[model samples]
Structure formats: C-alpha cells, structure tokens
Target chain A: MLTQTVRMLGRLGETVVKGVAEMGFAAVLLGEALFWLAMGRRREQPVRLAPIVAEMTEIGLRALPIVTVLAVTIGIMLAIQGIYTLRMFGAESQVVPGIAFSVVREFAPLITGILVAGRSGSALAARLGTMRINQEVDALQVMGISPVRFLVVPPLVAMLVMVPSLSLWSILVALGGAGVYVSSTLDMTFAAYARQCLEMLTLGDLAHGMGKSFIFAVLITLVGVVNGASVSGGAEGVGRMTTRSVVQAISAIVITDMIFVFLVTR
Target chain B: MNGVDRTSSRVAIEVRDLVTHYGERKILKGVSFDILEGEILVIMGGSGSGKSTLLNHLLGLLRPTSGAIRLLGVDITKAPPREMQALRRKMGVAFQGGALFSSMSVGDNIMLPLREHTRLDRKTMEIMARLKMEVVDLAGFENLMPAELSGGMIKRAALARAIVMDPKLLFCDEPSAGLDPVVASSIDDLILRLRDAMGMTIVVVTHELESAFKIADRILVLDKGEIIGLGSVDEIRNSASERIQNLLHRRTEEVELDADAYLRRLTGEE
Candidate 1:
C-alpha cells in the first residue's frame, strides 16, 4: 500500500514534469519562429512569403463556405432566442441591439475560434506529426535548415493574419443574418435593424472580438505545433496529437478569451 | 582534385571514446574509430546494438553522455549551433525509409537545401537539381511527387537530395532494408559510384552482410554496443571473435547468463 501510494505520486510528478517540459519546448519554438520571421532574410533563411500565402489560402479561404453557413445559422438562432427572451419583459424591440452587441463582443470570435481550432489547427498538427514520423523533420535539421523556421512560421504567419479577418467577417455576416430575421419577423425594416445595430456597436466592440481571435490564433498555432513536434509512436501518435490539438486549442482560446475579457473590463 | 584531393589520406571523421546511455542502460561504451577522406566505413550491427544511437551522435541529433566526434576538423559534440550549421553544409544524411518531404515534388525536394542555404540564381538551382536527379538516375521523374514514387525510386530520390549540394561527408542509414535484392544491389552500386565519382567520405550502417562486403573499404562490426572487430573486409571475415563470426554467419546466439545477476537486473535491484 505504501509503495502503491508512492508510485501514484511518482506518476503524478512525472506528468507535471512532462507538462512543464512541453511548455518550455513550445516557448522555445515560438521564440525561434519569431526570430526567423523577423531576421530570417538577414540570415539567408527567410520565411518565404509564398508558403505563408498558401497557408492563408488553406486556413482562411478554404474555410469560407463553412464559416458562412455557420455564421448565418448562429445569427438566426440568436435573434430568435433573444427576441423571445426579451419579449417576456416587453422589450422585444431591444433584441436588435442585444444580438448586435453579443455577436460582436463574444459570439463571433468564440464560435470562429472553436471552428478554426477544429479545422486548420487539427490539420497543422496532423501534417507536422506525419512529417515528424517520417523523419522529414530530421532531414531538414541535417540539411542545416531549422525545422521551426521552415514548417511552423509559415502557418504561424498565416494564422495570425487570417483568424482575425475571419472573425471580423463572421461579425458582419452574423449581424446581417440577425437583421434579415428582425426585418421579416417584426415591424422593424432591415435598414432600421442595421441602423440600430450600427448605433449600439462601437469600434471597441469590434476590436474586442477581433482582438480575442488574434489571441486565439496564437493559441491554436502554438498548441498544434507543440503537439506536432512532440509526436512519437508513428501513425497512431499523429492521430492522437491531431485530436489533442483541437481540444487543447479550443480550451486555450476560451481561457485566453476569458482573461482578455477580464483585463479589458478592468 | 578540385581543391582538397579526395585520396590525400586525411581523416574526415574522428570519433574518440564516445559513451552514451538511455536512463541507466549504457548504449555505446567508449567506442572510437576514424574514417579517411573518400573512404567508405560500413558499421555493421544488429537491432539494439547501438549503431543507430551512434549514428545519431555522429549527426549531432543526440548528445553523447561523454566523449567527442570531430567531422572536418570541428568537434561536433562541442560545436556552437552556427558552426554545426556550417558543418552540415559539407555533410549529408540519407535516412532510413528515404524521408522525402511529401509536400514537394522530386525536383523541389532535391533543390530544397540549395534554395534554403544558397543565394544562387533560379536557373542555376534548377540545373543543379536536375543534374542530381540524373546522377541518381531519376531524370524523368522530377515532376512526380514523393508519394507517387515506388520504394526504390523514393530511396534513389533521397540519395539525389542528399548529394545535391555535393557534401564532403555522406551517411546512408539502412539504405537497402526494405528494397528487394535487385534494388538493394543498385543502391550498393550507387554508394560505390558516389564515392568513386564524387570522392565523398561515406558511412553506411546496415546489418546486411552482403551489401557491407561489396561496398566497405573498411568494416566495423559492433555487438552489444562494443566494437568486436574493425578492419578491412577480408580482415573482419577472418577475425576469430565468436561474436563477429556469429554476426557474419547469421547464427543464433545462446548467451550464458549468471542467474542471480539476471534476476537482480530483471527485478531492478542491480
């Protein structure tokens, strides 16, 4: 029984240590990525603009159809829910302002974060993990190319640019959906619904959602790359880490969103 | 004879008393050897015999528990990252399973190191890449993706990429493991041609007795992480070491073990 307890504690300690080591590795990866991005040209190892653009097309543009469909559904649902909920207090007209404010400040970035974490974030992990298994990463190393600079930074740059744009796009599309619903279901014109939304929403409100997505982008990239770089056990390991990348990315984005909200409110 | 003559008898790689461990299990125990410029050193060992571990050490992928490896006059174990990178430009490694990047076409994969490391013109880079493909007999396959290639073709493409920059030191890890005998023989021929034609010092790690004999200027036989024999091919074949004989003859080993010690090791008490 004594040995059992000791073994349990040892396992727990080992987990904690591994977690810390993973974090350290991630921090170093991020640092190297930033360094290469900033100084790569001077050092003759420039983070090529071509790969970043390709990644942007994959991570952002290819995701457009789903983002559009989901945004519209979410907007319509929010309007229907908010209108009925506020009608209990005889404030049905207030639903326009409510939908606009919530979508811009919270829903847009949060939903997009989860969507992207499930989509491109999982792809990044799986791709990198497969490369790791194939020893392609080692091939890069022996050729004197830093694997982080070659593999991670392109997607890093792409994610940093594209996620915020997607969030902003989500905000606009969702508000449009809400406006259509409000115009059809109520006495308010679509123009009036849009006008009310414009009045209620501030530049700061737009920044709040876009800003949160910016942070989420970093979280997603870091989680994916870190899990990828640490993958072992071959094909099974790649699949495991790809799933973990999505889960951990979503959690990190949500927690970071909370922290951002707290600090912004302060 | 371009600058440094390949047959000048200079030591291209010098390993001294290399020691390593994984947890408490000692792997390479005070191993030492040298390879002359343009020579082919075949390191022969079975699985878990520490050849891979030693290769990783030589490549600077894994730091040894102790001792040093010098490649081209710079001690790799203690070299700075910048120096290592510079040294890597003069060295190439063709990994087991032909680790070509799946995302790139054969041409792109071969030219990757040049594109990353050099400031050559696009035309020059393309010409160099094509030249390597031709050298590895993959001239018409440049447009194909790595996934589209057969196993033998992938290995040849990997060899092309490894030698594209004309590295002075080349290492091939299990170059023939998964290929059929015909393909394997071709890979052996390619290794010999690379040495003779390019004058690159080569080290090949394999358990295949026939391939080693065909290509090795010298062979180093390792067993249980120790060098049981190191000599020319004929010398190694004639050596009286039972371990070397067993390895060469593909005989099953009947290891005599002390029961008490074995039990202690199994129980984690020793």
Candidate 2:
C-alpha cells in the first residue's frame, strides 16, 4: 500500500512537470511569432496577405451556416426558458431584455468560440501535423523559412480578424431568432424587440464580448499550432493531435471565458 | 585508394568527436570525418547504422550529444538560430520522400526558396524555376501538383528545388531508394551533372551500393553506429573486414542465441 501511494505521487509529479514544460514551450513559440510579426514588418518581410485572406474564408465565412444554426437554436431555447420562469412572476416582457443581454454578452461569443474551436482548430492541427509527418516542415526550415511564420501567423491573423466578426454574426442571428419567436407568440412586434435588444446593449457590452472572442481566437490557434508542430509517429500522431487540439481548445475557451467574465464584470 | 590530401583541398564540412543518443541508446559514436570541397561524399550504411541521424546533424536539424560540426567554417552545433538560418540558405537538402508542399504546384515549390531569400522579380524567378525544371528533365510539368508526379519525377523535381538557389553545399538522402534501376541511374547521372554544373560539394546518404559507387568520390561505411571504413569505391570494394564484405555481398550477420535466454524471452521471463 505504501509503494502504491508513492508510485501514484511520483506519476502525478511527472505529469505536472511535463505540463509546465509544455506550457513554457508554447509561450515561447507564441512570443517568437509575435516578435516576427512586429519586427518582420520593418524588415519588409510582413506576413503575406494572401494566406490570411484564404484562412479567414476557411475559418469564418465557411463556418457561417453551422454557427448560425447553433446560435439560433440556443436563442430560442433561452427564450423559452426565460418565458417559463418570468411568466410565474407576471414579468413575461422581461424575457426580451434577459435573452438579448445573455446572447450578446455571453452565449453568442462562447457558443461561437466553442463551435469554431471544434471545427477550424482541429483542421489546422491535422493539416500541420500531416505536414510535419511528411517532412514539409523540415523542407521549409532547410529553405531558411520559419514554419511558424509561414504556417502559424496567417492563421493567427485570420482568427483575430474573423472570430470577433463571427461572434457578432452569431449575436445578430440569435437576436433575429428570438425576435421571430416573440413576434408570433408574445404580443410584441419585431421592431419593438429590436429596439429593446439595442436598448439593453451598451457599447461596453459589445466591446467586452468581442474582446472575449478575440482572446478565444488566440487561445485556439496557439493550441492547434503547438500541437501540430510537435506531432510525430505518422498518421496515428496526426489523429491524436487533432483530437487533442479540439479538446484543449474548447477547454481553453471555457476557462478564458470564465476569467474574462470575472474581470470584465468586476 | 588514394585519399584526397587534407592539406591541398579545402574542407567543406568537418565533424569531430561526434556523438548522438536517442533516449538511452547511442545512435552515433564519436564519428569523425572531413568532406573535401567539390567532392561527392557518400555515407553508406545498413539499417539502424545511424546514417540518417548523421545526415540530420549535418543539416543542423538535430543537435549532437557531444561534438562539433562545422559547415563551411560555421560551427553549427553552437551557432545561434539566426546564424543557423543564414547557414541554411547557403546549403540545400533533398529529403528522402521529396517533401514537396502538397498545396502548391511544382513550380511554386521550386520557386519557394528564391522567393524567400532573393529579391528577384517574379518574371526572373519564373524563368529561373523553368530553367531548373529543364535541367532536371521535368520541363512543362511545373504547374502540376506533386501528387501527379511519378516516383522518379518527384525526385527530379525535388532536386530541381534544392539546386535552384545555387547553394554552396547540397545534401541528398536516399535519392534512389524507391526507384527502378534505370530511373535510379538517371538520378545518379543528374547528381553528377548538378555537381559539375554548379560546382557545389554534395553529400549523399544511401544504402544502395551500386548508386553509391556510381556517384561517390569518397565512401564512408557505417555499421552499428561507428565508421568501419572510409575510402574510394575501389578501396571499399577490396576492404578485408568481414563486416564490409558481408554488406557488399548481402550476407546477413550470423547470431548464436543462447537457448536459455531465447526461452526466457519467448516466455516473457526477461
């Protein structure tokens, strides 16, 4: 029994140390990428614009339909739940402010981030992992090009630009869904619903939500790129990293969202 | 078996007391050698003989456990990242599997190094890429993806990309590993032509004796993580070592297993 306890403690310590080392490496990679972006501009080696545009299309534009569907469903469900609870207190009209506030300030960005993390983050990790296995990353290195600059920067820039845009799109779709449901069932006009949504929303709320999405974007891309760059063992490695990228990205989004809520709300 | 005089020829690469380990097992054991300028040096070894490990070290892709590797007078084992990057620009590597970017056309693959390192106009880069394609006998196929190329065509295209920058040193790993005899010889011929035309020192790592003998100016034979012989093809051919003879004649090493140990292993007794 004593030996078992000691072995368990040893394993836990090893895992903790490994985790800390991995985090340190990831932070260094992120720092290097940012440094190159800041300094590469003055050197006339700015990140290429073409790949950024392509990645934005892949991560944001192509993701519209699914993000819209998920956001709308979430909005309708929240409205139903809010109405059920508010009707008990004779405050059914309060449901509008409640749904609009929650969707804009929290649900939309969080849900969109989670969905995009699952979709685009896994794709990026698998693609890069396959490239590493194929030795194309080594080829780039031999040619004097940093793989992080060539691969990570484009995705990083695209996520920063697109994730916030995607969150905003999700918020609009959710609001429209809630408005449509309230118009038919609750004695409210779509114009009134829109006005209430706009009235309940402050510039600070919009900025705060968008800021959370931006941070989520950075977290997802960093996780994916780090896992991808470290892949080995051929197809099995790629598959493992792809799964790991999604799990870690979603976990990071949730944890970051909690931290943002605590700080921004305070 | 006349050796090139170290005092007469300039050294392109000088490795001394090199040692490398993966986990607890040593991969390269204190190997030392010098590659002369403008000579084709072939590193020949059987499977698990550390040929690939040494190649990776020479390319500065892997750090040695203990040793020095000087490529064109730059101590790569201790060089900073920026210095290594600059050194990499002066050398080129053709990987075993071609390693082309699947997303890009062959033309873009060849033009990548130029676009990254040179300020040449797009038109000039295109012309240069085309010239390399012609030299590699893959003209007019640049717009096609790497997946569209045959085994031999892929090797040729990768070679074109490697030499497109006119690097001072070139490294080719298993250039003829998976090709037929005819195609393999053609690649060997192309390696010769590239060296003659570009005046670059080349290092090739291969287990194919015929290919090695055809293109090498000097041969280094490695066995079990150590260099057993280093000389011209004729010298290696006439070598009296039983290991070298076995390798040349394709004889498997004879092992006498202890019956007790074999039984224990079979039963997982260790």
Candidate 3:
C-alpha cells in the first residue's frame, strides 16, 4: 500500500508537469495566432454574423450598466477608506492620486475581469462545454467546420475587441466616483481631482491595464475552449470543468496582473 | 491518382484492426470493418461495447491505438491535414446526441458544411440547405434553434446536416436513441430513403434491437470488445450461441427464484 501510494503520487506529479508543459505550448500557439490575426489572416466566417452580434450584445454590452454601478459602489468604498487612513496620517490630499492610480492602473480592470469571469466566462465554458461533451464539437468537425475556428475564435475575437472597452469604461466610472467623493467630503474641487487623475495617469497606466485585461480575456476564453474541448464523463463532468474554468480564469487574471505590475512598475 | 482512378477505384471507407482504449482499459480489440459502395452496415452492441469507439475511429475524431483507417481508399491513420480535410468533405456524421450547435439555427447548422467545404454562393447554399431540411421533413424548422427543437426533430435536423453535402459515406451513431418508437421507425425509413436517393454507403451504430433489425442489410454485434455475431438479422436470431440466444429471447423469465425466497423465509431472513 505504501509503494502503491508512492507510485500514485509520482504519477500525479508527472501528470501535473505534463499539463503545465502542454499549457505552455498552447499559450505559445495561441499567442502566435493572435499575432498573425493582428498582422493579416482575417479567417472570419460572417455567416453567423447576426448571432455573433447578439452574443456580443449579451456578453459585453448588457453587462455595462451592472459593471458601472458596481464600480461606483466600490469606488465610494475605496474613497471612504482612503479618507479615514489619510486623515489619521494628515495626508488627506493624497486621496485623489491614491484612489485614482489604484483604480485606473489596477483595481478597475482586475475587479471587472473577475466579475466578467464569474458571469461571462463561466457561462461561455458551461455553454460551450455542454455543447462539446454532448458531441456538438464532433458534429461541427463532421460538417467540415473547425470548432476552434467557429466556436472558439468568434467569442475570443469578441473578447479581444470588448474587454479593453469594458476596462476603459470601468476606469472612468471608478475615477468619476472618486472625484465626486473628494468634492463632497474633502472640500476639494472636482476639477483639481480630475486634473490630477489626467496628469498622474499616463497612457502607460491605461495601456498596461488594458494589456492585462486583454490577456485575461484571451486566457478566459482559451480556458473555456480547452476545458470545453477536453470534457468527458458526462453532465457532471461539464459542470465541474465549467466551475474549474471560472476559478482558473480568475486566478490566471490575478497572476498575470501581478506579473504586469512587477514588469511595468519596475 | 487521377480523378477517374479516384472515382473508379476508391473504396469509400475502410477499417483494419482498429483498437480504442480509454486510460488503462481497452474498449475495441482489433475491430475491423468496412462500408463498401452504397452498403448499410448496422453495428449493434450492448452498452460499453465499443461501437461508438469504432465509429469515432472511422470519423478520424479518435485515432486508433495501432491500426489503419482508410476513408475513400486513402489511409487516414496518418493522413496529412489537407488530405484529412478532403476526406472529411466526402463524408458526414450524425452523432448520438444530435449535436446541433445550440448557437446556430437549423438552417445555419445545415449550411455550415457547405460553407466550409464548397465555394458555392450564399443563395445556392441556402437552397441546398433548404432542400436537405425538406428531405428530413424539417423544412419549416430552419429558423428555430436546436434548443427549441424536440428530440426527434433534433435528430432529423442532424441527419439533414449529415447529408447536406451529398456525402459518399454517412456515419450515424445511435440515430434512434432517446426517440419515441414512431419517431425511431420514421428515422429508419429516412435512412432507407436517403440511401435509395443518393446511393450513399452508411454505417449506423445502435443497440436498439428493433431499429437494427429494421434497417440493417448486415448486422455486427459486439460483446466486451469482440465481435460475437456478424450476419443478417435472421442469422443472428437463429444463432446457436447461448449468449446470443439469451439476448434474442430474453431468457430471464425461465429462472425460478421462489426456491431462494422460500429458503430465506425458512432460515428466518438473514
């Protein structure tokens, strides 16, 4: 039994290592595809253009109002906390720059990615994974359609086009809410706060944040497609993979954000 | 090969010593079969009998462990990507779940293959898709999503998509599964009609005994990864093997269980 357990442990370790290696290769391949997409090769199937439009509306556009409201609420919480801490330190004036940098540079995109991963990413994985496990992928293949080219590519293209837009929207809401808070509570001019945000937050800040969001968006969709493609066992298997996709996507976003922070901030 | 050689000499589909394994357990142990020009071969098996695995192997969806699978006389076991694509253009499969893309309407599902494999214009593809849908008796369902269709409707729609390309070989995995008896019989009729209309070879994997009996020109039954019986339905029924006899007649009624029950009562129920 001891030897069996040791053997099992060794196999588990090998499996994990192999999975990581495969994921690395997949990442390289996906990155190459994305790069080529940027260069040329449109490979767009516009036959389902209407459905793609509807899905984009449902996944990206519909979530905007909710995201805006959530960002405002969180921004207010951040302002209140910043005010209390800065008051104790006699450094209340830093509140504008403090909340502004954090929101525009990090919190806004990260929080929105997490929210969308929970809401949209899981839905994508579950919907696609269910289709996959039920043999819809095979059906597409037999139909001479590439499942990756059809199902995976469109949503990913939608994400690449929409996530940066969503992140920019999130940053605006957060900074706007912070400006309102500073004007009302700290007796500071809204113009001054807004000016500081514009001056302190460079294109670098916004671009870095958008870059992270874009990678996160791609990661979310890739995980969804991969998990969906690899699904087996049955319905319960799909459910489990969907849940894991969401969790893994969120974790991947956070880790990527940290790495981006280190690289950009350094 | 020239186009004439391809047309005259090509054997639609072939399988030789196909084996499939999941993890440690082997499911198909050197299974070999072929769908010749315009033949309908029904693969029958109890659950877990590897019929689906064999079908998947033929479809090039699952690579066999160590065997050759040829489609249209070209060995697809190591076929190049372009060749695989060309081979796929000449065949279609209807999966057990009737796996129509949930996101696409019935018309789109039927149109997808034409769009992928042909240079036909939108108008022509639309007409062809409509024609295929009408063939499957799903003409008005063009606008409906797969989610909106009933089980039998989904199956029929899938069949429509399968034949939309006028494929040389059609693979149907459990075409009658999870359908009403009337619908199952109707689907069998559709298979026959399609065969007659197109002279297309077909391979159907199903365990529904009645459906198998109805449509099969030849039947192959698998038990635990081995072919236990292969012949016409009449031959299978008259098989001398005890397992085949038991399956055909369903011999459970012959057992006398009252002896065990009486003994349990006499022994005061353990």
Candidate 4:
C-alpha cells in the first residue's frame, strides 16, 4: 500500500513537472515569435501579411453569424431574467444598467472568448498538428526556415488583432439586443436604454473587457500553436492535441476571467 | 562503382561514436562512419535497426546522448543556432512520405526554399524551381497540390523541392519504400543523376536491398543499433559476418532451442 501510494505521488509529480515545462516552452515560444516578427520587419522580409489578413477575416467573418446569434440570445435572456427577478421589488429600472454593465464587463468577452477558443483555436491546433505529422515542419527546418517564424507568427498576430475586435462587436450587438427586448416588453424607451448604458458604463469598463479578450486571445493562440508544434504519434496525436488545445484554452479563459473579476470586484 | 563515384576522399560527413537514447532505451550505440564527398552512401537495416534514428541524428534533428557529428566541416552536435542555420542551408532532406506542404502547389513548394533563403527575383526563383522540376521529371506538374498527385509524383515533387536550392549535401530517407518497381528504379536513377550532376554527397537510409544496390557507392549495414558492415557493395556482398550474409540472402536468423528451457517456458517455470 505504501509503495502504491508512493508510485501515485511520483506520477503526480511527473505531471506537475511536465506541465511546468510546457508552460515554460509556451512563454519562450511567444518571445521567439515576437522576436522573429521584429527581425522580419527589420529585414524588410516580414512574414506574409496576406496570411495574417486572411486569418483575421476568416476568424471574424466566419464567426460573425454564430457570435451575433449567441450575443443577442444572451442579451435577451439577461433582460428577461433580470426584469422577472427585479419585478418582485418593483425595481424594473435596474434591468437596463444591469444588462449594460454585465454584458459589457463580463458576458460579451467571456462568450466571444469561449467561442473563439472552441472554434478557431481547435482548428489552428489541428492544422499545425497535421503539418507536424506530415513532416512539413521538419522539412521547413531542414531547409533553414524556422517553422516558429513562418508558421506561427502570422496567426499570433491575427488573433491579437481579431479577438478584441470581435469582443467589441459582441458588446455592441448584445447591448442592442437587450435594448430591443427591454424596450418592447418593459416601459423603457430604446433611447433611454441606450442612454443608461452610456451613463452607467465608463470607458474603463470597455477597456477592461477589451484587455481581457486580448489576454484570452493570447492564451488561445499559445495553447493551440504550442500543442500543435509538440504533437507526436501521427494522426491520433493531432486529434488529441486539438481537443486538449480547446479544453486548455477554455479553462485558461475562465480562470483569467475569474481573476479579472476578483480584482475588479474587490 | 569505380567510375561512377568521382569522390576524392573529402569527408563531407564524419561521425565519431554517435549514441542516442529514449528514456532508458538505448537506440544508436556508438555508430561511427564517414560519408565521402560526391558519393551515395546507403544505410540499410531491418525495421528498428536504428537507421532512421541515425538519419535523424545526421540531420541534427535529435540531440545525441554522446558523440559528435561533423557535417560539411561543422560539428553539428555542438554548433550554435546561427551556425546550424548556416549549415542547414547547404543541406536538403527528402522524407519518406515526400512531406510536401499540402496547402501549397508543387511549384510553390519547390520555390519555398528559394523564396525563404535567397533574395532572388520571383521570376528567377520560378525558373530555378522549374529547372529542378524538369530534373526530377516532374515538369508541368507543379501546379498540382500534394494531395492531387499520385504517390510517385509526390516523391518526385519532393525531390524537386529538395534540390531547388542546389544543396551540397542531400539526405533521402526511405526514398523508394512505397512504390512500384518501375517508379522506384526511376527514383534510384534520379539519385544517381543528382550525384553525378550536382556533385552532391548523398546519404540514403533504406532497407530496400534492390534500391540500395542500385544507388549506393558505399553500403553501410546496421544491426541492433551498431555498424556491422561498411564497405563497397561488392565488399558487403562478400562479408563473412553472419548478420551481413543473412541480410544479403534475406534469411532469418535461426536460434537453436534447448528442450529443457522450452519445456520450462511452456510450463511457466523459472
């Protein structure tokens, strides 16, 4: 029994060490990515802008319909739930500011982050994982091209640009959705709802939400690319890495959101 | 073989006591050899004989447990990243599966090395890429993606990509592993042609006896992660080692069984 316990403890230690090592690798990868991008710019041989632009358009445009639908539904749900609960105290006026504050400062960024992580992040991991299995990554290395520079930096740049934009779009659409629902059902005017959102939400709230999305973007890209780059054992490895990338990205977003909320609420 | 290899004893690759391990399992055990300039050296062994591991070591893809690998006069095992990159520009590797980027056309795949490494004009790079395609007999097929091509075509396109930069040292890993006899023979001919035309020092890792005999100026036979034979094909054919002879004759090794031990094993007794 003692030996078994020790063995189990040993396995746990190994897992911890491995996790720490992977995190270190991810940090170093981000540093190398930024360095390579700067170097490429300095040499006037920047990583293809075409791919970065394509990735951005792909992420934002392909996700637009789903993000819109989800945001509107979430906004409407918030209005319905908030009014129903607050009507007990006859505090219906609180619903507008409540929706505005929660949607901007919390729901929009979280929803968009989880969506991007599940959709784009998983795809990124799978693509790079396939490239690894196909030995195209090795071929690039053999040809003196750094795969990190060529395969990674463009997507990293794209995520940094796109995620925050999507977050902003989500915030607006969600607010518009809540305003519509509230104005139609309750005695509130659409303009008054809009005015309450403007009055209640400071620029600090918007920045805070955008900042959270930016971090989430980094987390998703890092998890996807790093998992993809390290994949082994053929096609099965790619599939496993893609799943892990999504899970880790979502978990990272939630944990970061918790921290952000704790700091702000305190 | 005498006239075909115009190699002048220039050691393009020199390995001394190469050793590698995965966790606790030892893979390559003190392998040492020299690949002369402008010659085709075929590394032959059965599955898990460590030829693939050795190839990865030679390519500097894996760090050795111990020993040194000097490629083109640079000790790759100890070379700095900048130096390694400089050395890699002089090397080309065609993997077993061709490994052409699936997203790119064959033409773009061939031109990738040129585009990334050289400041040459796009027109010049295209011409250079086309020239390689013609050399590999893949002319006019450069517009197709890797998935669009047949197996043989993909291998030829990969060869075109490898040779596009005019690398001095070329590595082909199991180049003819999965192909029809006719196509495999053509790939062997292409390897010979590349060596003759470009004066390249080529290292081919393959277990295909027929292809090895066709292209190898020197054959290095590995067994259980150790070098059992390294000589001209004629010398290897006449080798006295039981393993070498067994490999040449395609005969499985026979172990004399002891009845008592067999009975013990059957009875699950120590």
Give the TM-score comparing model 1 with the true structure, all chains together.
0.96
The numbered model that scores best in DockQ is 1
The 10 consecutive residues of candidate 2 chain A with the worst lDDT sum are: A39-48
Tens-digit lDDT string for candidate 3 (A139-192) = 777665666666766677777767778888989998888789888998789898
- How many residue pairs clash in all the candidates, one count each? 0, 0, 0, 0
Please estimate how well model 1 matches the true structure, expressed as its whole-model Cα lDDT: 0.91
The TM-score that candidate 3 achieves is 0.88
Candidate 4 lDDT over B98-120, as tens digits, reads 99998889999999988888889
Per candidate, native contacts kept equal 0.80, 0.71, 0.80, 0.74
TM-score, candidate 3, first chain: 0.89
- After superposing candidate 1, which stretches have Cα over 4 Å from the reference? B1-8, B258-270
For candidate 4, list the clashing residue pairs, or say none: none
- Candidates' TM-scores? 0.96, 0.95, 0.88, 0.95
Residue range B92-144, candidate 2, lDDT tens digits: 89999999999999999999999888889999999999999999999999899
Task: Give me the displacement of residue A233 in model 1, in angstroms.
Answer: 1.1
Better of 2 and 4 by DockQ: 2
lDDT of each: 0.91, 0.91, 0.81, 0.91
Residue B199 local lDDT, model 3 = 79
lDDT of each residue in A1-266, candidate 2, tens digit only: 99789989999999999778878877987897897788876643567889999999999999999999999998888888888899999898889989988999899999999998999999999999999988899898888888888998899999998899999999999989888887777889989989988898899888888999999999989889888988999999999999999999999999989988998788
